[model samples]
Target chain A: RMDQGEKKLSSVDRTPLHTEYVKSKLNLEGKDEVRKLKLFMKYIGVYGADARISGFSGYICELLIINMGDFHRTIEAFAAMRGKLVIGDPENTESFDSPAIVIDPTDKTRNAAAAISVENLSRMKLCSRLYLNGKMPEYVQSNGQRKDAKDRGTNLRVFRIKKPDIMDDILYPQVMRFKNAIWEIMERNDLRPVSWEVCVKDHIDVIIESENKAVPALKIHQGPPVDEPSSLDFYNKWINMKISRGPYILGDRIYVDLIRQQKSIGDVVREGLKKVNIGKNIDDQKEAMEIFDPYDTGKDSCALDLFLSKFIFRAHPPEKTSRNTRSS
Target chain B: RMDQGEKKLSSVDRTPLHTEYVKSKLNLEGKDEVRKLKLFMKYIGVYGADARISGFSGYICELLIINMGDFHRTIEAFAAMRGKLVIGDPENTESFDSPAIVIDPTDKTRNAAAAISVENLSRMKLCSRLYLNGKMPEYVQSNGQRKDAKDRGTNLRVFRIKKPDIMDDILYPQVMRFKNAIWEIMERNDLRPVSWEVCVKDHIDVIIESENKAVPALKIHQGPPVDEPSSLDFYNKWINMKISRGPYILGDRIYVDLIRQQKSIGDVVREGLKKVNIGKNIDDQKEAMEIFDPYDTGKDSCALDLFLSKFIFRAHPPEKTSRNTRSS
Candidate 1:
C-alpha cells in the first residue's frame, strides 16, 4: 500500500544490504534538524549517546557524546548555520579547525548524569577528527598527499600549550603554586581533594588565553556539591577558616541556595560563607565572629555554618525571628 | 629525618625529582601484572566497545561494564600477556614484539572492573613504564636519550576497504542475496524493513577464513523506519523479503540460541540494530512476549532476548530459558 497516513514502513525487505541510508525526500535542505545533526554526528564519530540542549548560542550548534572506554569523547559541533559545507560535496566541507575537548563527563562521585552543559559547549568547537595514529582522518589520503604522517591520529589535542616554554617555566609554576594553596585550605577543613589530574591540566592553551585566570573554569565548579568531592574540599576549607567556633556543616536551605546559584561560580564562596580562606590559614588567622550564645560551645554543630549564618547568611534578620525575640 | 617508624616524609623536599630515580622506584617489571585484558569491537570504520572475558568459554566476570569513550585511547595492559621484559637496566629493557593491549589500572566502568577476575591477573608478566603516548617514559631513558615522539601515540587501526574490487566481485554480491532472503522473512511477519544500505553484512574475511563452514558473522544494516510519505515508499521496498527480516527484528528465543550455537556474531547484529529507527525499540520487544503466555513462544522470546543483550549483558541467561528455546 502507498501509505500516507503515519507512513511507517510496514515490512522488512529480503535483500543483501551494504548500509542503510536514512530515507529522506525533503530535498536535502528541509529535514528534522535533530536527525540531520545525529547523522552528521554518526559520521564524525560513528556513534552518539549524550547530545543535549534544544540549541546553542555561539559558533556551536550542538554537542554530541560517545562513551568508549575509560573516557567520554565530546564532539562540539560548530555553528552549522554558518560556514557549514553543503552535505555530499567533499570539496565544500568546512575545515573544522577548532579543537574538541573530551571530558570525564560525569564526576563518578557526583550523582550527576554524564552530560555536557550548553555553556561548556559554547566554550568548545569541533576542530578536526583525530585518528588513532595521532593524525586527522580527513587530511590523510592513500594518495601519498602529505609528506609526513603527522596528522594521522584522531585524538584531538584539546588544550594546546601556547607558550610551551613559558608554560613549562612560568605559567605551570604559577598554576602549581595556586593549586598548592587551594589544597592547603581544603586540608585544614578535612575535605577530600577536589581536583582530578585529568581536569587540572588537559588544555593549558585555552585556559591561559582566557581572562578567567583560574585553572578550571567556574562552570566546572558550579554543579551540585553533594557528589563533587573537589567542590566539597573547597567548601570545607572555607568553612574552617571563616566561621569561628563551630563545625562547618551547611544546612539544607544553604545547600539549596548554593545549588540555585550554580550558574555563578563566585557565589558559592561569597554567598555561602562567612569567612574567606584567601590567605594562609595559620599566619593570617584572625577571629571572624564572636560566639552567638556564650554558654554554648561551637562543638555541638558546624562552626563554619554558625559563622556563615551570622556574618554572611543574614543581611537583615528574618522579620519572624525578630518578632519572636521581641515577644520573648 | 629518617624516622624508622614507617619513616614517613612529612614534607616534600625541594630536590629536583629525577626521572631516573623515579623510574627505579616504579618497579616496572612487576607492574604489567596489574593491567587487564579486553576485546576491541570495531564497525563502520570506528570502534564500538571493549569486552574483557575469561577465554570466550563464556564464564563472565562480575564487574564487566562498558568503557565509555575514545576507543583507541584505552590502556592495553591487560590484553593477551607478553613475555616478561628485562627491567632495571634501560639498555636491556627488551620485550617481545607484541600488540599493545593492557588491562586498565583505573577503569571507571564497573563492567571492566567486574570482568577482571584475579585469576586473569595471574597470567600477566610485568613490563616497563611506557607513557600514555606509547613512548618509554624518561625514567626508562638509556644514556639520557628521550623516547621518540612517534613512539608515544597508542597503536590501533580501524581497517578500511583497501580493495573495492574484492567487495564488488566476491563480497557484496553474496551479501545482497542474504539480505534479500532475510527481508522476505521479515516482510511475511509485517515487520519493519531494516536498511539494506546500512544494515549489517556478513564479513567475507570471517566467512572464508574460519575452518568451520557454519560460523556466522555480522554486517551493517540501514537505519530505522521513517514517517514521511516519501520515506515509506523506499522503506517498504527495502524490507520486502525474509533475509531483510533478520536485520529488522529477531524471531523468538530458539532462533537466537541456534545463532549462538553456531558461534554466530550476535554483538555485530546488535550494533547494526542500534542504527535503525526501530533499534531503540528493540528493548520494548521483550514486553511484547507477554502476549504468548500459553503459547510455545518461549523459543521466540529467547531469540529476541539474545538479540537484545549486548556483550556486557550476554554471559548469564535466566535459568527458566533453555538454550534450545532461543533462535539466532
Candidate 2:
C-alpha cells in the first residue's frame, strides 16, 4: 500500500516484519528512550519533516538518540557543534551537504536531516545551549504575550495575499519564494528591509520591517568606463536628458543623477512583482495582494508570535544586568 | 647662480658649458625641431613642469623629439601607446614609474616626464589621436566662448578661499589636496560628487558638482554577524536606541536603520574639514571659505574656460550626426 503511488497508508501497512526491521537497524530492542526524546523534540517545535517546520522528524530523532546514546548527550553534541555537522557512515555522510546531516541507518542514499533548514539548525543549537545554560524558559516557554507592534515604532510593512488552494508542501515554499522576491525588489529599490517573516495559514502574511518607506528623489546612475566605446553612447544619452548634476566623469567612468521614477517602497514592490519570478501559484493571485501597515491591519496572532519568538526575542541572549547587579 | 637655492636662474646660468652638454647629449646640432615641438606642446597646454600643469617640461619635449626624430612621430607614438609608456634607455626607464616616462639624456638617474600626470598623459593621447584624425580644431582651438553657467542647469557648487602667499608649485598641489579632501567628505556623507576642478590664482576656487545637495534622513547601518560574540552587544546597543527601523537579522548578520546626523552637503563639508588633512596652508584659512551657487558668484573666465575645455566639451567626441547623415 505504501509503495503504490496516491494510495494512503493505513495500519494494515504497519506489519511486525517492518517494525522488526526498524528495531534491528536502529538497535532499539526494549528501550522507550527514543520515544521520550521524540516527544521532547516535538515540544520544542523541531519535530517535523514538512517545509514549514524544516526540523527533526520522528525517525531522525530516533536515529540521533541511538547514535548519541541519550537526550543529554544529543543536546550537548548539538550545543558543541559549529558550522556543518555530519553523522552516520563516512561514505554516506560525504554524499550529503547541509547545516545538519544525519544519514539513514536503513537507506545509505537518503539523508535523515535533509528537511532541516540552516535557520532551524541554528535555532536548535541556540536552544540546546540555552537549555544547558539554564536559560531555556526565556525562549522555550511561549507566553503568547508580546509588546504591541505599534509600541516598537518600527517601519513595518505587512502584506497579505489570499492563500492559493495548495498542499502545505507546495504552498509554504511558494510563500517563502514570494517573500524572497519581495525582499529582492525592496533591496533593488534601496528600501533596506532589515528583518522579515512569512506566516502561512488561511492567508499568506509577509511582515517586512524596512529602514525607510521611500527612496530619495535623485539617485546616482553609473555609466560605462570612459575608455569603453559605449561611453560615447552614455554621454550622448544623458547630455541632453534632464538630470540633477552629471554627465560628469569620476575616475575613469561617467555618471549622472537621474530623477528616480518610483520613490515609495509600496510602488517599487507593486511594480517589481510583475518583473520577478514569484512562484506560479502565488503569481496568479498577486493582483489581489493587500499591503498594510502593522497597526492598520487586523493582526494575526501567529505572525506576531513568530516575529517575537523567532526574530525579536531570539536575536540575542538575555542581558547580564542581573549578574552585574549581583557583582556590584 | 643656479646652484644657489634662493637665487632665480637667469641667462648667466645658461652658459655655453651647459648648452654644449645638452646639445651633445640630445644630438641637437643647431636644429630648431625640438623648439618648434615645444611651442606646439605649450599651445596645447602640455608644456610645463609646475604642479598646476603636470605636463612635459621643455627639456622632456627636446629629449622626446631627439628620441622619436620629430614632433609627428612623437604624437603618433603617444596615440598608439596603451597603459604605461616608457621612453629612453631600457636600463633607466625601469627605475621610473609613471603613466608616461622619458629618461633624461644627460642624467639617466632622473625621469624627464615625472611631473606629467595620468590626466595630462591621457589628454596627450586624446589630443594626438584627434590631431591625427583631423578633429584638432574642435579640441585645440579656444574661442573664449561657452554656454552660460545658468543655461546648462547643473548643480554647480563653487567655493572660493583666500590664496596663501606661497609658490605656484606648493599652492596648486595644496589646492588639489583640498579639493580631494572636500570630495572625500561629500562621498562619506552620501553626497555623490560627479566632477570637481580647482583654480588657484589670487584666490583659490574649488568647484564640485554633485548628484544632490543633501543626503537622505535614514541610512542603513550594518552590524556584527549573528554567530559572532559582538552581535549580542550590537543588539543591546540598538535595542533601546532611537533608530528608524532595525537592529535585525539579514542572513547571518545584524543591521539597523539609524538617523543621519548631517544632511546638507555644506554642513558635511564644513564639519569634515576639521577632521581631514586638507594641506596645512588651506586648513589654516578654512574658516574664510565661501561656498556659493554658480549663478550667485561672480564667474571667473579662467574657471569657465577650464570647465568647458577639459571636462564639459572634452568628455565625449562630437556627435556623429554628420557621419550618420553622410551614411544615410
Candidate 3:
C-alpha cells in the first residue's frame, strides 16, 4: 500500500490482536467445530459468503461455543431459549437492539453476533429446538425452498421487491425501512397483518399474513374539533355527501364515517405506493412488485418457502399443535 | 334541617358567603342574566333537571357568567371553543379533570363544572356555535327523539338498556359505565364506534354509531412467546387444529390468525353478553337487545330519533322546533 509522506504507510498481513482474539475464542477441539457446524447449517437455507441471514456467523458460532463452553451446550441453550438471547453484555445493556446480542470479550467495542437477523436467529433457534425434541424438521437436513400453505386456510401475500444497485450495507436497512413503512400503511388501512418478514438478497421480498385479506367498504375519518376554523372546511367537504354518516362532534372532534373508495389490499398498496417517493431501486425496477397469493404456484415456490420458514415452520417448535385454532 | 348538637343547628335559608359569592359574580343587569339563558337551554334537550343530561348546574351557570362577564360572552366562549376548555386556574392548574373546568373563585377547593359529561359539554358547544353562527339548529329549540342514518350509507346501532331500579346518581353512572363497557367491547371486536351517547330517560338508552355494524370472520389470535413454557401448551392446543394457521413466532410471542365463530356483530354481542355477568338490569331486560337497522323501518322509527340525537343531529341546531317543554 502506498501513502503520501504526510500520511505514513504501514502494513501487517494479519493483525496480532484479531488473530489472538479468534484463537482464544475457538477453544473447541478438532479443526474448528464452529466452522463445520456453520457450514452444515448453511445448506438448508440462504447461508453463504453473501447471505442475508443476520446472525449465525462462524465467529458468532465460535463466540457462542466459547460462551456455552461447547457446541452441544450452545445448541442446548438455543433449544431451551424462548424469547431474548443475551450473551455477555459487557456494558450491561447500555444500548443493544438485535434479535441476539453477543458482546466481544476481547474487544468491548465489538459485538460478535450483532449482525444476526430475526429470521436467521429464529430459524436457528427453531432448528435447535427441533433437533433436541427429536422431531427434527427435514428442512434443516435437506435443502431447497419452503412448502406452500395451499390448504392452510391462510391469507398470506408476498411482494418481491428488486434490490437497488447500491451496496448491501446501504440496501439492507432501506429494505427494512420500506418493509416497516408498508406494514404501517397496511395496518392503517385495516388489513391488520399478524405476521410479516422482509428478506434482502438477490431481491428484497416482503411477506405478510393478515386477517382481512380484503378490505372493508367503510372507514371512519376523524376531522378537527367542531369549533376550530378547520372544522368548517372538514364539514363543508363531507357533511352533505351521501356516503357520510356524520358531520357531528364526538368528544372534541368532528368525525365522519364514510365508504372507502378502494376496498382491497392490492388496490391499497398499488395506490399507496404512488403517493411516496420510495427511492431509486423500487422506483426504477421495471417488473418489480410481484404479488404472490398464498395459493399461487410455479414462480411463488421460493416465496412460499421463505414465508413458511419465517412464519409457519419458523424453526421454532409449534406451541399449539393439536386442538381447534379458530374461535367458536 | 337540624344538625347534631356537637356540630351546630342553623336556620339560615341562604348562607351569607354563598349569597355574597352569587351577587359579586353577577356583574350583569337586574333579573340574573345567567339564570334566563340557563333556563332557555334547558327546554331543548337534556339540560333540565332529572332529564337525560349530566351536570351543568345553576351554580355552574353563575360561574360561567362571572367568567365571561355576560351571557353572550359565555355563549361566545362555547361557540369558539374547539377541544379542551379550562377556566380560571388562579393557582395555575393543580390537577383538574373534567369535560369542562370552571374554578370557583369563592371556594378555591371546588370545581363548579367538575360533574359535566363530555356529551353535555359538546352539545352546548355545538349549539352555542350554531346559534351564534345564525344556523340555529331546530333540535336545540324543540324536544323529540333523533333521526336515522338510512340515507347516509352508514352503519349505526343503538342499545337502550332499561334503567336499573336505583337512584338518579347511582343509575346515571351505571348507564355511563355500561355505555363505555359496550363501546370498548365493540372496539375490541373491530366494530369501531365513532359516536356514542348514553341517555337514562324513560329507558336507559345507550345509542352507538359505528363503522362495522357487521363482523368479520377472520381474527388474529396471539399466543405466548416462543420461549415461554406456556408457548408449548399453546402450541399443543392449536398446531393440529383444523382451523389453525401459522401459530408462528413474531418478535417475542406466538400468534395464529384464524376464523371467528360468530362472524356477525349481533351474534358476538348476544353470545358474549351471555358469558359475562353484566349486572341484572341488562340481564333482566328481556327482548332488550333490539336490532334497529336504519333501513328496517317498522321497528326503527323510534330508535332513529334516539340514535340521531345521540349521534347525527347532535349539534346541527335541531330543525324541528316544537314539542313538550321540560324546563321553563
Candidate 4:
C-alpha cells in the first residue's frame, strides 16, 4: 500500500520535499494512509470501502486523492465553494461476501464491454393523417406531379346517402337550418359578403352567398342533439342518409362522438330563448329561440366556430388511404 | 323583416341622423336584402349555399354574408392594420374543418375547456409515469413538479415507461448504470451529490477509472467477452464465485447493470492494461490489460483512479419491480 501511494504521489509531480513531508506524517502501509484517506473521505462526504475496486469515482475521491487534507478542513472548504457532499450506505451492502476488489478475469472484460454498449431505448414515433370533406389547398410536387387541394373546394359538403349499397341514385339533404340564422345577421347589419379580415391577425376569411339569400353552415358538431326531440329525429335521418351515402367523408378530424360538458345544448338554447322580451306566446318563444339564438347564438358561438374551423382545416393527416376513395 | 329590423335598430341610440340612415336601410324586403347578401358572399369568398344553412350565428353569419368586395376589403384593411382573423367555412372551402373551440364558460376563469363535437375532433390527453434512479436531493423538490425536459438536472436520470407489460425488466439495469455513472461523477468532483440539473449538463466530471473491474458484472449476463482475448480469463472464475452467491447491490446513489455499452469488458480491460507500463517480462497482453496503466511521474492520479472506479462499484439492481415508478 505504501509503495502504491508513493507511486501515485510521485506520478502527480509531488516534489521530493512534499513527498518526504507526507511520508514523515503518515506511514502508508501502517494504516496511516488509510486514516488520512478516511479523513479526506469524511471531508468530501462521499466514501465507500471498495470504491477503488468497485468503480465508484466522484468529487470526494478527487478531494482526497488529489487534494488531501483534514476531514473537517476539506469539508469546510468544499462547503465554502458551494459544493455538496453526501455519504450513506446502500440498502443492500452486505450482499457481496467477496470484497469488490477480488475481481475475476471475466469481470475485467465485462466492464470494458459494458463501456461500448448502446442504450438508446424507450422512444416512440407516431404518425397519423386527417381528411377533409373537400380537397386540401396545399400542393405536393412529387415525381414532377403538382397536386393542390384548392380546386376541390366545391366538394366540401359532407353528403348523406339514404342507401349504402346504392348511394348514387338518391341524395338526402342534411339539416342546414342554421343558414337562416346567418341570413338574419346579413340582412340586419346590411353586411355584404365581401372578403375581409376579421381582426388584426393574418388569417384568411371566406364567405359564400346565393344571388338573393344568405346560407348557413354548421359551425360546430355537437354530435346528435340530446334533449331536443326535433334534433334527435334529425340525427336519425342524417345517419341513415350517411350510411346510404357510403361514408364519403372520412378524416382524422371527424369526431364520431360528442363529449358532455357543463350543460347540454338544449338547456343553453332554452335559457337564451327565455331571455327574449317578446310576447309570452309559445310560437313567439319558439321563434325567438330560432331567430335570436340562431346557431345557438351565445358567447360560445364564436368559440365553437373556431373549433369547427380548426378541426376541419388544421389537423394531422391520417395514415390510411381514406376508405372513402373505395366508396367512390 | 323591415318592421323587425326597425324595432331592433330603434333600440340602438346613435345620432338621430344615423338612426334615420339605418331605418332607411332596414326598409328593404327579402329579395333586395338577399341581393345585398349575395354581393357580400361573393366578396367574402364563402359559398352561399352552405352559408345559408350551415347554422352560423347572427354575428358570424353577418360576417359571412358581407359582400365579396366588402369581405376582401375588410381583410385587406385588417391586413393594413396588422389585424388577423380565424373563420370557419362549413363548405370547407379551405378543405379543412373546425375541430375544437376553447373558451371559458365564465369570465376570468384561469382554467378553460375546449368544445369538440362529433363532427369535429381534436386532441386527447394521456397520463404516464417516468422513472429515475439515484438519491434525490433537497433541490429536486423546489423545482416544478410537472415535467419540462428543458429544465432537467443530473442528480436523477429519468426514463418514461409507458408500457410495462410488453417491456421485460430492461430499464432497471439501464437506470442502475445511469445512477452509477452519476455516482462516479460525484466522487470524481470531490463534491456532494448535486441536483439533476448538474447531471444533465455534464457539469460533474464522470471519472470511469479502469473498465477491467466491470468484468464480473458483465459475466452474469453471459454476453460476449470483450473483443480482444487476454489472460484476464482467470478473472471470470473469481467473478463466478460471486454469481453463485447472488447478484445485487443497492445504494441511494450507486447502481449496477448487466447490460452495458457496445464494447466488451475484455476489450476495455485489454486496452487499459496495455497502456499500463508495469515493466518487466510480463508477456501476456491479457494479463497486462488487467494491470493498471503506469503513468509518468508528473500526472494527477485522480483521472486514473476515477477511470478505474467503475470496475469496483457498479452492480445491476434486483429484478425490475419499480421500473415504471415515476421517480425510482
lDDT of 4 at A103: 16
Collision count of model 2: 0
**lDDT tens per residue, model 2, A1-328:** 0234555433235345335655775654324667766665655566677877777776677677778887888888877776666898887788677777887555566666888876566556655655676654433322233344454434678778888888888888888998999998888776767677777766788888775577645466888755554655676676556564545554445666556654677778888998876787888778778888756765442444455444333422212111122211
Candidate 4 C-alpha error for residue A79, in Å: 2.5
| Model 2 chain B poorest 10 in a row by lDDT | B315-324
DockQ of each: 0.00, 0.13, 0.29, 0.01
Which ranges in model 1 have alpha carbons more than 4 Å from their true place?
A1-282, A286-328, B1-123, B126-328
Write candidate 1's Cα lDDT for B170-271 as tens digits: 433443343343344333222223212211112111011111122222112333222122222332343223221111111110010011222222223233
Better of 1 and 2 by TM-score: 2
In the range B112-168, model 2's lDDT, one tens digit per residue, is 678887766655655565567665443322222334444443466777788888888
Rank by TM-score, highest first.
3, 2, 4, 1
Instruction: Output per-candidate TM-scores for chain A, rounded to 2 decimals.
Output: 0.17, 0.81, 0.67, 0.15
Candidate 3, residues B1-328, lDDT tens digits: the string is 1225544422142346556888865655723778766764664343533323554777677767776777788888887886556887646334566777777665555565666767567767766766676654344421232233553345666666565667775565556666776777778887667666555545665667676656655566888756666766675577556543555655566676566554565665666665555555466662466545535544433334444543334422222311232232
lDDT of each: 0.23, 0.64, 0.58, 0.24
RMSD for all candidates, in order, please: 32.0, 9.1, 7.5, 41.4
Local accuracy of candidate 3 as per-residue lDDT tens digits, A1-328: 1124544322132246556776865654723667656654663332332324454665566666667766677778887886557877546444576677777565554455666666566656665665566644344311222233543434677777777778765676666666676677788897777666666545677777776666655567788766677765676676446643566556667777666654677767766766664555566542357777746544533434445554434432222211133221
* Top TM-score hit: 3
